[model samples]
Target chain A: MPDFDFAQPTSLNEALELFAADGEVRALVGGTDIVDQLKTGRRNADMVVDLKRIPELQRLEIEADGLHIGAARSLTDIAEFPVVLSDYKGLADSSVLVGSWQIQNRAGIGGNVCNAAPSGDTIPALLSHETSAIVASSSGRREIALSDFFAGPGQTVLQKDEILVELVLPPIPDDSASSYLRFIPRNEMDIAVVGAGSFLHLGSDGAVQKARIALASVAPTPVRARAAEGVLEGNVLSDELIETAAVAAVEAATPISDVRGSAEYRRELVKVLTRRTLGISRDRIVG
Target chain B: MKHISITVNGDQHELLVEANWTLLETLRDHLRLTGTKEGCSNGNCGACTVMVNGRTANSCLVLAAEMDGNEITTIEGIASQGKLNPVQEAFIKDGALQCGFCTPGFIISATALLQRNPDPSEEEIRTRLAGNLCRCTGYDKIVMAVEDAAAMLRT
Candidate 1:
């Protein structure tokens, strides 16, 4: 970690002004990733702005519209929040799996998304939930669909002068449920080889009224398995139907081979995890 | 240099820290608290685990400037008044460590686990200690130490 100026701005406007002043500034949230990047020379900063001090960025609230999760709120809080756990189980599951318990205590969902790792656990879940990011700059504020937030690996659409303020998840329908699953060689502390998240809304007749599937570690960014989702929408979920959709999910993936797994193996895991997570989501739907 | 005030192991210290200094470096070099070992310097290895505001974090990943006005409990803070903490006593009684490089981290993690969940099942103990890696011990003794520590604390 090279020497840099650190500023803890108490307000979003102040943080924005600091960011506007210097393009070399990086927002320090959890520091779980940024600190390692600094140490490895993967990233450098002349000035690091700490956003945790901003009151708005630290809030986690459940309201009529939906859940407003502050970008800087710790993963531990998001994972354990009763409303999040019950209403957004897939996001909660991913949140709990972000890192170990210690990492969860420091890492924030906002940082997780902003870091934009292709293997980020929260992105798939967020994508499935139709989450939106509320970003703020000195000039104004804007909301972007989380699905459109990431540009590529370690990249997001956020400008240098903008900060991700919060994530808003619209209320999931009463008949809807979601699940997130990832394949890892080890039980813990490893990045996902392939990750899948499914959100399903069952019609009164037990047919799939709507379906959303998202995957991670398969492309430059987290992706929606629109083809697989198309297979499920307006259809009944059966073993054969689920298997067919899983195959479509495999088709949706564009995984790269590396030390963790071969591209072929990742594609296979995508099918398996997609089927399994879809099943879990279907089972979670209330009568 | 950033001037930060922090409370560590029941002592208050107001110190000047370089912006690049991690809490691990500040603890080990500046404060001379060497118990918190630096293993990976990254978040992967838990050797530099410490409690910040009652939650365990990798000190290597935490900026020293962020410690201002925060309560930190390192390996040295676990014991009280010259007495070994229950987790430490259990580890010694169970011979849970070999080489001892990862002991402080494991102890701190187990302590935090017990603080949150006083009576954890064997599976819970295993999951809680997963972040702390030990090469020498096959982890059976470490698991037993945490269970015994739980029982001892309960009594």
Candidate 2:
């Protein structure tokens, strides 16, 4: 790891001030990703701007508009949080799948998104739920849809000197439920070969009023399968209906073969996961 | 070099270290607390696992300065007056170790899990120790040891 100055600012204003003074400062939250990058020589920042000390970035707030999850809030915090589990079960489940308990305890949601791995477990869940990132910079703050946040692999739309302040999940539509599912070669510790998340809203007559489906590790970025979602929207979920949607999801995937699994295998798993996730999500909508 | 002050195993030490030094390096080199072994310097392997602020963290992935105000418990802190902690004893009795290089981290990680879950199920024990790579013992004895320690802790 290259040498760097470390600064721990006690407040958001102070952290911003330090960031404004220097362009080379990189914010450090959980150290789950940054530390690994530093040690492996994959990343080198001249200064580490420690954001853990900033109290504002650690608060999780649920309000009338939506749920605001602090950028620095750890995955353990999300997985164990009752509101998250009860309201956004898909997100909670994804949080549990990230690395190990030790890593989950230190890994933050913002870091996961900003790391921008195609296999990032949280991205599919966020995209499925129509979440947006509340990004802040020295100049100002703005919101961007989670779908628009990722530019490509290991990249995001976040500008230099800007930090992700919070992930804002809009209020769940009535009679709606969401679920996330992933297939890995091993169990919880390993990254996903294919990940899928689904959100389904049912009408009074038990027909699907709206549907959202997102996939990960099968594309350049977490992608919403509009064709798959179109199959479910305004229709009733049946075994045959879900199979058609799942096939559509496979058509939407752009998986690349890697050490984890072959692109064809990933596409197959995406079909399986999409079917399973949609079934579970539909059940939640009805039950 | 950067001067950092951190409390390890309940003792405060003021020392100067390289700017890029990790908490694992600081403990093993600067303070000579060699009990915290370094495995995968990245967060994957838990050989450098330690309890920071009552939570298990990979010491190798954490900078020493990042833990200045936190309370850290390493493998060296598990024994009280030369007496093994119950978890350590359970590991020994259950034959949970083979090479013992990863023992310190396993002990620390298991202890932290027990601290949080008190009486975790067998599955919970396995999931919690997933980060700690133990090439030997096949983890059967390690899981048994944690279950034993949990029973001891409850009683």
Candidate 3:
């Protein structure tokens, strides 16, 4: 790692001020990703700002609008949170799969989103929940939809002086449940080959009222399978319909051939994961 | 260099650390607490595991400068007084180690699990310890050791 100045900012203002005056400053919460990147020289920083000490940055608020997750809270805290496990189960599921117990205890949801890894397990889950990013900089703050947040692999639209303050997830819909599942070669300590998250709402007529399905590792960024979702809504979901929707979910994927899997295999896994996640959400709602 | 005051294994140490120095490097170098082994140094292997404010974290992934005013527990801190902790004794009884490079991390992680969940199921133990990798002993013995530790601690 390059020699750099380190700043542990206790307030959001302090953090923003550090970034406001800095050269190559990187904001870190858990240090799970940034430390490794720095050690390997994949990323260099003139100064590294630690944000976990800020109290407001660690706020986990449940309000009428939705759940406001403080970006600096550890994944373990988020995943095991009562409200998250019960209301945002998909986020909980994906959060636990980020790394091992050790990593999970240190890694933060915001870090995963900010790292902007195409294969980040939590992105699809957050996207499926229609989450939004609340960012703050020295000048002001801005809100952006999670879908529009990512610029590319390992990139976000967040400016040099901006830090993501919170991720806001809308309230769980009525008659709805969400689930996230990912395909990995090993049982643990591996990145996703194909990850899928589904949020389903059913109506009295035994038809799907609303559907949101997002996929990870299929493109340069986590993407919503809107085509599949469009067809699922207002349709009476049968096994055949589910299978067809799964096939449609593959349309959003533009996966590359990598060591974990080939492009063809990833597309195939997308179908399976999409189907399974949808089925799990449906079952949770009905059961 | 930054001056940081961190409590490790109940001993408070005020030391100067480089901005780029990780908690693992600081523990092994400045404090001369070499019990926390460095493996992978990228959070992949848990050989550098330690308790930060009572939570298991990969020390290599943490900067020593950020740990100021925090309480940390390493393998060196687990055994109380002159007696081995239950987890340490159980590892010996179960013959859980081969090269033992990963033992310190496993011990820290297992001790943490037992602290959090005293009656964790077999699957729970396996899942919790999965982060600490062991190439030798095939993990069965380590799992057995955790189970044994839980039992011993319960008694």
TM-score of 2: 0.96
Candidate 2 off by > 4 Å = A21-23, B1-3
Per-residue lDDT of A1-287 in model 3, one digit per residue for the tens? 78989999888898899999848999889999999999999888999999999987788879999999989888999988898988888998899899999999988789999999999999999999999999999899999999999999999999999999999999987788899999998889899999999998889887998899999999999999999998899999888888989999999999999898999999999999999999999888887
Q: What is the lDDT of residue B64 in candidate 1?
A: 92
DockQ for every prediction shown? 0.83, 0.78, 0.90
Q: How high is the CA lDDT of each candidate model?
A: 0.92, 0.87, 0.93
* Candidates in order: C-alpha RMSD to true structure: 1.0, 1.5, 0.9
Q: Would you list the clashing residue pairs of candidate 1? A: none
Q: Is candidate 1 or candidate 3 better by lDDT?
A: 3
lDDT of 2 by residue, B4-93 (tens): 677788898877767578889988887889999988788887999998888889888788777756788899998889999889999999
Candidate 2 structure quality by residue, lDDT tens digits, A115-216? 999889999999989998988877988999999999998889988868888999989877898999899778667888899999888888777888899999
Using all chains and alpha carbons, the TM-scores for the candidates as numbered come to: 0.99, 0.96, 0.99
Candidate no. 3 TM-score: 0.99
Chain A vs native chain A, TM-score per candidate: 0.98, 0.97, 0.98
lDDT of 1 by residue, A1-287 (tens): 77789998899989899989855999888899999998898988999888998999988988888999999999999989998888899999899788788899999788899999999999999999999999998999999999999999999999988899999999888789998999998888899999999999988887898889999999999999999999999898788999999999887799999998999999999999999999999888852
